[model samples]
Target: MQLPLIDLVVFFVYLLGIILFGVSFSFKGRTSNDFQTGGGRLPAWALGMSIFATYVSSISFLALPGNAYQSNWNVFVFGISIPIAAYMAVRYFVPLYRSLRSESAYFYLEERFGPWARTYASVCYLLTQLARMGAIMYLLALPMHALLGWDVGLIIVVTGVSVILYSMLGGIEAVVWTDAVQAVLLIAGAIACIVVIFVSMPEGPAQVFSIAMENQKFSLGSMDLDFTTSTFWMVLVYGLFINLQNFGVDQSYVQRYVSARTDAEAKKSTLLGSLLYIPVSFLFLFIGTALYSFYQANPENLPAELQLSGNADKVFPHFIASELPLGLTGLLIASVFAAGMSTVSTSINSSATLLLSDHYQRYINPQISEKQSLRFLRIASLTMGGLSVLVGLAFNGVSSALEAWWALSSIFSGGILGLFFLGLILNKTKKPNVIPAMIVGVLAIAWVSLSPVLFSEGSIFRSQLHTNMTIVVGTMTIFLLGFLFTWLVQKENGKPIKSSSD
Candidate 1:
């Protein structure tokens, strides 16, 4: 593939923009708090954009559109459920968590539960983030590889280290502000790609919809309520619960709330993030369905490899590589890079915070001063960044990335959410029962998630679930079981129980 002058210009601009944003923050970082939570100085809008950008990753950029092309537009409805989850987060979770005044989300777990529970929850978060970062790297690299013949391995390393360099230097301050910029770029790039495709296609939007409807592909379900399908109900339920886990317990998001100057600001950010997702997702999926029409009209123009994949995930890059005008291709490709960089930088920095606050400062160096803690923060950043790079290298393909992420996420999320729900919504158990309940909850979810048959379409019990919803269900089941067992054991011991909210 010969490079065009316009494409090169767009690519350079994208790379330069992120590097510059990161450099700007380096000079402003003064203390560990400044590094970790922007010295708690951010306003609602900036935090909202950070939350939106952080939540929408390369996975959605590629997978959701590809899913719309392949599975139908039923998945788009998940966007509707997100705002509802966001509402709950703002109304209940963020305000309550802000009152606790902890940098690491798991630190609150320690206060309400115990050391063992905190460690368990944090480790789960750490592992899930590692897999997620790897997946993001892998997805972003795919477009570059197809369009520019860039080595995927080298691209992953360059992206990983570049993100680490800036994130380590600027911390949350850099991640949040740069993510706001990336969110705009990401949306602009997607819209640009759609506009270009529409102009090049033989028919207009009406004709495109006609083709989609002819194939019965523009929908949520095939009008079947069969348990053997990833239906709309399954997606909605899964989305609602998965989001609950995210807003309720995920440390990465919780850290953002703590970064806000006021509890009200944090809640406002949460609300804004939820409201924005609906339009953002609708646009992305609309572009995807449009791309499907373009390909149907000109199948011969697509790359040989893409046609062979029989999956539309590869189509976005294929269109960019083969059909788009020169400069626009560069812009869209840059968008892909922005997606990967924004997500990896945020995850690395957030995980570093978890390591230092939840792990090192608590267990390894209890008497450390602020200056000494800053030193450890830098060290944790380097170590976690390196580990994520290695994980990215190990990701052979996108499917592996998805599996690794889901498996790691399920491990701790169920237990953490369960423990929190116990704390916030139930008043049945003493603190002493927390560790035991968390242990059981974690193990139970891990078992269900890892079992090959659990997510299989043929499974009688598990086949009815979507991946995200299944994890949420597993998490909830553990939470309830843990609550019951804690209630029983505390009563047997004649111990006065404290509510999870206490």
Candidate 2:
């Protein structure tokens, strides 16, 4: 299954070029302000593309198609929820971020809810990003394993080193610019994949449609008003909540807002990133459907194991390795790498930024010099990158990258997203009111996320609600409890209610 010589060259060239290219920015990142915010000089469109690339990580690049091929378009509804989430982010979150004096995403959390809230949110962010980096690393390795027969662990280490080095050298400037370029590569590669699939079918391109229709592959899942499964409504709720967390409170995104030249540009960047993904996501899903038809008509093309439901993730990579022409195969491989690089670089840089702004600079050394800060940022990025590599190795046999990420994300995201909403909705929710609500929210999240392992599978005490509801349930639980407590305290003290959301 190893790639031919030509394909190998293309892949290696991209890897080497990106590292050298990013390292060229070492001088730019030597200073504190330049490293973190790039003087707020980047144009809107490039920032938008970087945001989109962050959204469409390699996990999405590979797993979206796999999900479509395995069943139907049920997951596509997640994309459908983006605009809704983006609207709220642009309308509310963007301006809030633009007004920040520091690039730290959790600064406002501390200002509003005290150091406890900021620390909790930052810790959750770091964990979530680590899980995210791990998933993307694993997904990036999957194809290389199928194509080059390389050990997945080796590929992850090599890839992680490359991304981490670039983040160290380039800072925010390098991440944003490379992300813009890599985003284009991913989109273009996806289109190329769909085209090849359409042309490869013996029955011609129209067969893609007929085959999709026959299997109900275009379904958005059952439209039933159910929360016990990944029904259309449930996924929309999940997507909205997750997207809100990402666009609203996530550090990676908050850094982008701080880096943008203007508030309007930042808002537009969010809109463009969200809107652009709709069609791009469609392309990936369609590629999967077309792949289903391509392989269905040529059953012998796919191995018997890959035909199993659990092996869907392998199909797309297997196809890229075995089916595409020589140069094109290299390009698509580069695309997967591009997707991974764009996201990993962004996360490593942003995570380091958070570490510096929220913890090291704030606690350990408030007066550290730019040169010292630069050194610290690089060391932090390297440490986190290594941790992520270990996490990726831990996912040695997962059936679906997307599934694993969804669960891991819920555990960390619920607290911040819920707490953020509570602060926004009930301005009177003081730091004292938050401690109990957060305690309850954490317990609720832990119960929902770990119930299957904690309780017997058939136990009625286990959470029967779909896992997609983890964020939604945790968020509402915190918000509701916090609000009730706030109101109760206000009434008991005989204080006049003067809280306003804005």
Which candidate wins on TM-score? Answer: 2
TM-score of each: 0.92, 0.96
Model 2 compared with the native: what TM-score?
Answer: 0.96
Which one is best on lDDT?
A: 2
Cα deviation of 20, candidate 1, in Å: 2.2
Give the Cα lDDT of each candidate: 0.77, 0.86
Spell out the clash pairs found in candidate 1.
74-220, 238-469, 423-500, 423-501
Provide the lDDT at 335 for model 2.
94
Stretches of model 2 off by over 4 angstroms after superposition: 397-404, 428-432
- Per-residue error for 411 in candidate 1, Å, reads 3.0
lDDT score for residue 340 of model 1: 80
Candidate 1 achieves a global lDDT of 0.77
**lDDT string, candidate 2, 80-124, tens digits:** 889888999998888887887688889888988898788889999
Off by over 4 Å in 1: 222-228, 397-399, 427-429, 453-469, 493-502
For model 1, give the 10-residue run with minimal summed lDDT.
Answer: 461-470
